[model samples]
Target: MSDFIAEQDRVLLERHGLASYEALWALTLEAVDEPNTERGGWSSVYRLDLGEQAFYLKRQSNHLTRNVLRPFGEPTFAREFRNIQRFKRLGIPSLEAAFFAKRRINTERQAVLVTRALDGWSDLQGLLESWPRLPGVERGEIVTACGKLMRNLHAAGQLHGCFYPKHVFLQRSSGGYAARLIDLEKTRPLLLGERDRLKDLDPFLRRTCAWSDDEVRHFLTAYLPIGTDIERWRLRLDARRRSKEFAVGAC
Candidate 1:
């Protein structure tokens, strides 16, 4: 069994008897989402509230992903935990893992990951729903922040495999809006150059229907270098969008 508890959260988790793999795996809490039972394995997320603080606890059993590095299989949460630490080291804003543990019992593998809740942050989807009511400056601030976050992520040679609006979170900060990413289970190193950027950005553009052409241009302005051909990039994205639409329609 291997486990890690962030020093700041050690006392609280210890107090709740959740400092070990067995304790966290056996914990019962309100589930936040439906269990994902895929690849003959299962995973679920739960909301754990302790006093005024809140945390998210994720549990999985035999949920494995086979890769070149680990041809056999490894717990998905293990990858996620490593990515969380990597993001922190790279100065990327992301979830703060409070505790992470994994263990093997016979042929079964189980893992748990806990992260502190972003108390004041709101998902980009929720913020977009109220975009009309927000001040123009605030909207621009958020768009710029989002663009910068993406630029930073890509520049660091990391790709957020799933870059949907819901996975991007924002909070009002002293400078402006601060952006953070979550649901990094699919995150991997960026390869194939610009193709990797398109892979991540396409889905985000498709899902965020609230953005107008002007808003998109503004975002790209913030994302790209001063002399880069933004229109060409937009064309490529549009072509990809159409291909996606056609694929879905054909299905």
Candidate 2:
């Protein structure tokens, strides 16, 4: 069993009597979403409001995943905690963990993860649903920002495995708009080659069906290098979409 708490958040968590694993384990709060039950266990997230500050507390019991490195299985939140730190070190914008702990009590493995909230950020899916109501310039700015974010993440040799619109978040920053990612449970180091880019971007393109060809071109212009063939990428992604559709239909 082990525990960690960010120094910056110590005072706040301590003040709320939640600085220890026992405190957090026994703490009761309203769940933000339905509990996820899988892998012979369950996990849930709760919104914790400490005065004016808000934090997300995730709790899980025996929820495990088996990978090549840990065939015996390990807590999923433990992997997510490590990935959060990796994103911070890579200078990628993502969730910030405030507290993390994992314990083994007899046959049950339990874990807790807490993160600071992105107060003013909005998910891309929500924004896209209202794209038509948004001004043309605002839409362009957001798309361009999101494109740059994707480019930077790929350049850093990272992959946001689940790069859906809901996982990508945007906020109006002092320098126009800034993009951040959430739901890093599936995120990992990117493999070499252009196929890696397609792996992440394909789902994004498929999900954002509201985007016109022109808007997609604008996004590619921002993501690809100058003089790069944007149309080629468009064609490749279109092929991938078709392949995925066929696979789904055949099932």
Candidate 3:
């Protein structure tokens, strides 16, 4: 369409031997200017203004780290793809991810993951950094949303390996409150009948004893409820714990 988008398409095709996200990438760059003011972490966040579709584009920088990996630092990009697809299937209220791109320049090959981007959404970590004490309806909404998110993830056979490590942020949405799972790069879906499914809790439960009883209670409260299907969660959580214990004793 535009010269910029067209040029990007060409570069992507030539560099990565793939041309999936060229237009999307161009759209992000075109909508952003030095004056727009961008906010992000180490990853390059492209500020976009698509009228009613305004967003802040996210992509993994070729050189970036800090709890963010290309999913176990694996080149497949399958983890990221599966998460988006699974969330969409579970009807989870999350930022929509679009196509991703793979590109290379010279001897270095790089991957570019693209998503619809978020404009108003804030991660739980950021929100809690401001409001630690969630009061009244906010607290209930947080509990509900947290439980729902976790349920959806587990239903999709995914284990979110980290939850702020005992104390993380909680996001307060306009209509309700929610908790954002930090370090999503550690996510892995339990493959059906796969033995590795039992190993999924290794990362999350490794420091279980580090969690204070109160902290653990708070998390369980947020994650378990009759309406949210407490029985299912308990079964899975206990199964995970038992698997870890057995693995340790076997060695």
CA lDDT, every prediction?
Answer: 0.88, 0.88, 0.46
| Arranged by lDDT, best first | 1, 2, 3
TM-score for candidate 1: 0.93
| Residue range 115-230, candidate 2, lDDT tens digits | 99888899999998898999998889889988998998888899888888888889986678899888888887898567889988888877777788899898899889899999
All candidates: CA RMSD in angstroms? 2.2, 2.2, 9.9
Winner on TM-score (1 vs 2)? 2
**Poorest 10 consecutive residues by lDDT, candidate 3:** 33-42
Q: Using Cα atoms with residue i matched to residue i, what is each candidate's TM-score against the true structure? A: 0.93, 0.95, 0.52
What number of clashing residue pairs does each candidate have, in the order they appear? 0, 0, 1
Clashing pairs in 3: 124-169
Better model by lDDT, 1 or 3?
1
Model 1: per-residue Cα lDDT over 1-251, one tens digit each? 35788999999988888888888988878788889898678999998988888999999999998899999999999999999999999998899999998888898998899999988899999988898899998999989988898999998999999888899999987789999999888999999898999998888877776877888898889888789999999999988877765532121
Please give the range of 10 consecutive residues that has the lowest summed lDDT in model 2: 242-251
